[model samples]
Target: MSESKRMDPFTGEKVEVDGVYENEAGQEEELHRGDAFPADLILGNTEWKLTEMSFDNHHEGRTDERLVPKEKDIDKQGKIDSPRRQMDRGKK
Candidate 1:
């Protein structure tokens, strides 16, 4: 029999596979491969365990925002502020 895959990723850690992860509080989040685990606002940093693997075979070359590290100058609303936005602001 094949062994079941187990993954327990912490906040700021890179996810090894695309899947759904659950925290100690039972909250779930879907994280893609190569994306960093996020920290909970109320719980701060917590360990996350993989609950399911992605069955998606489609690869459209798109990645979620979690691919970027949390320290990369995201806005208060958790949106990434791209360099293009800076240039646009300068033009105003």
Candidate 2:
């Protein structure tokens, strides 16, 4: 089977899932799949917030049973880290 992949938030590597990588500062960081995004991993230059999201639930009398909890943060439109901080995130 093809390996699943996700870009390392710190190094921008489209690495295979469950792999480990070194940062620009030579810090070893492990990668995983199926986990919530880490807000702290985002350097201090990005804007992120919880936007209301929902799913259609037709089985429970057409009522939405679960509003996604607020543990995850979605990036605000066009919000991104500055090049300087993006560089810092990869440093020791």
Identify the candidate with maximal TM-score. 1
* Tens-digit lDDT track of model 2 for 13-89: 23334444444344444545443333335352222222222233454545342432233546433333344533345
Q: Which stretches in model 2 have alpha-carbon errors above 4 Å? A: 1-16, 36-92
lDDT string, candidate 1, 1-92, tens digits: 34566546789999999999998778999999999999988899999989988876537646665645466555534444575533343544
TM-score of model number 2: 0.23
Candidate 1 residue 29 C-alpha distance from true site, Å = 0.5
TM-scores for every predicted model:
0.53, 0.23
Candidate 1 local Cα displacement, residue 49, angstroms? 0.4
